[model samples]
Structure formats: C-alpha cells, structure tokens
Target: MIFSVNSKVLEKVLSKVYPAVPTRTPMPILENFLFQIEEGKLTITATDMEITLRSAIFIDSTDNAEMVVPAKLLYDIVRSLGDTLIQFQIDIDNNKMQLSTDNGTYNIGYAASSDFPSIPNVNHDKKFSLSAKQLKKALDQTAFAVSKEAIRPAMMGLLFEFNIDGLRFVATDGHRLVRYSLLSEKSEIPEQYVVPERATSVLSKLL
Candidate 1:
C-alpha cells in the first residue's frame, strides 16, 4: 500500500493518539499505534488497555492496509521533520514500512494488524456533547483531586454522573474532593461512569 500526507498534519493526529500508548507494559504490542488505511482515510489508534484514543485524517492513497507501528518512534520522527510531504510505502510481505520525505528516507518494522487488540465499539444511543472549553474546565477543576493510590481503585479516577439535574463531575482522594456541575441540560436517565486518570489527563490536552 502507498499513501502520502503532510508531515505537520500527521504530527497533529499522532499527538492526540500517542498519549494512550502505555509508557511501560509487559505487552509490547500496547506500545504501538494501530494504523488502518482504507479508501482515502488514515486512522491511527493507541490504547493502554484502560484507555483508547483514535484519530483519523484523509490522505491520498493507492491501496488499503492495516499495520501496527511503534508509537513513540513514529511520532518522534514525524514531529522532527520540517513541514513536508511524507510518502508511505508498506511492504506487507516483509513486514516493513518505509517513510520517504524530500530530504530523507526512513524504514520502520511493523506488526500484523491481527496482533493488535480490537478497539471496543462505543454505543452512541445515549450521548451528549459539550463544548471544548466547558469540558476542559470540568476536567481541570476535578482532576487534581483524583486519587493516585492503587488500593482504592474507585477513587483513582473521575466520576461522571448524569441525571435530571444535569451532569456532574466528581473526584476525591480521601482528603481532597471536587465536584463540578453543569446544569444547562437535563437527562431522564441517571448514569455514572468512572473515567481513569490517564484518560482524563490525555483528554485535557486534546480539549
């Protein structure tokens, strides 16, 4: 498969996904990004088991392919390059991916897409949207109080509670606690979810 995309554009997408790649893992496969190219779009995904981040961009490609490439290595290389066109050449038979630019050509080994874990499909039947500013503010207000202690697993993340009163963001670490609510809208169904601290931290930067 072959495809070409702008270096800066690819860098931006990588930045959003790379945070999900685990810094240290017994499963080395978790340290790579799942690259899926189909039709005219390129999708990049990374996950640390608990959190998954995926981003996509349109690209000019001659064929479709999927492979897992080292997240840190690929992101570092792309960010270091000056704004230029990057042509990607995938050699599936040899398990190698070649990236060529105006000044340099680089090659990186890749694993089969089958080796990468499948990303869970999120159900969107019950969904709501929040402006970036509002979401970021909530995260900033509560994230500091989230527990870092592993013994109390439930308190190690942020709580998202949805009810008729609106949505509430809660975090506590025994001594410190924070609750931020947005009562602009109401929901008939009351639901709650615990978002891991890693996910919240990464999401804050993206917002």
Candidate 2:
C-alpha cells in the first residue's frame, strides 16, 4: 500500500506521540511507530505500554494498510528531508517501508502491524476544561511538594477536587501539605480523582 502526507504535519503528529515510545524495549518493534491508513486518514500511534498516544491526520488513501516503522529513524528521516510532501509505500513481501522525496528514496525495516498493542480508549465521562495558564499555575504551586515515597498512595498522587465552587489541587507528605485553589466557571463538578504524581508533572508541562 502507498500513501502521501504533508511532511510537516506528519512530523508534528509523530512529535506529539513520540514521547510515549520507550527508548529501551525487549521487542525492538515496540520502539517503532504503528502506522495505519484507513478511510483517507493516516493514524500514527506509539506507546510504552503504560501511556499510549494516537494521532490521526488526513491522507489520500482508500486502501487499508498497517506497518510498524522504526520511530526514531522515521522521525530523523522526515526531519532531515525538510518541508516537502512525502510518499510512503509498503512492500509487505519484503517487510520494508520505502519513503520517497523528489531527491531520493530510502528503505526502513518494518514489522507486522498485528504485533502492536491496541491503545485503550480513554473514555472518561467526566472531563474538565480549564485554561492552560490556570492549570500550569496550580501545578507549579503544588508539584514540588508531591511526595516520592510510593507507600503512601495519597501522597504519591495529586489530589484533585472540584465542585460548583471551584477547583483545588492538593499534595502532602507527613511533614507538610500544599494546596492550590482556583475559582473557575461555576458548574456541577462532582468528579474527583487522584492523578499519579508522574502524570501530573507531565500534564503540567504539556499545559
């Protein structure tokens, strides 16, 4: 199967998902991007098994095809190729992905797409929308005090509480406690959850 995409868009999508790709894996294919084309859209997914990332961008393809291409190599190739339309063709028999530009063509090792783990859908019925600035501030004021000791589940995660009044972020160790409260848009917010401290840090940076 063959398809084409905007190199920059592809690069951006890959960059967003690349963080989920593990640097060290027992199966080398785990380090690659699972590329799937269907219904004129191209989806790229990467996962370290704990967290998964999947991004979709429109492409000109009707036929369905899937393959795992070395993530780092694909990232490097597109980065070096500059801004240009990229052509991708997969040779299933040879287990290779051919990337083409006006100037050249390159081949990269491929693995069967069936080997990639399915990314779970994060279907949270309760989703909160908050300003990035407010979220960052809340995290900044609270993240440093988060306890690293795993024994205390409460301290190992950020305590997030919300209601019609506002939102609150709290973290505590036996010695100290830190909390940040923000007055947000008034609404019904019965949802409350403890986000792992590690995930809190990452989401904070992303915001």
lDDT scores of the candidates, listed in order? 0.93, 0.83
Residue 133 displacement in candidate 1 (angstroms): 0.8
Tens-place lDDT digits, model 1, residues 1-207? 878899999999999988899999999999999999988889999999988999999988857899999999999999999799999988999999999998999999999999999988999999877789999999999999999999999999999998999999999999988999999966788999999998899899989
Q: lDDT at 14 for candidate 1?
A: 94
Residue 59 shift from truth in candidate 2, angstroms: 0.8
lDDT of 1: 0.93
Off by over 4 Å in 2: 26-29, 151-154, 186-189
Q: Weakest 10 consecutive residues, lDDT, candidate 1? A: 58-67
**TM-scores of the candidates in the order shown:** 0.96, 0.85
In candidate 2, what are the lDDT values of residues 1-207, reduced to their tens digit? 888888898888988888778888886768999988889988899887766778899988788888888899999999888899889887889998899989899889888998888777788987778888888888989888888987877788888888888888888876789988887554495667787776777677566
Please report the candidate that would top TM-score against the real structure. Answer: 1
Task: Give residue 29's lDDT in candidate 2 (0 to 100).
Answer: 67
Clashing pairs in 2: none
C-alpha RMSD values across all candidates:
1.1, 2.3
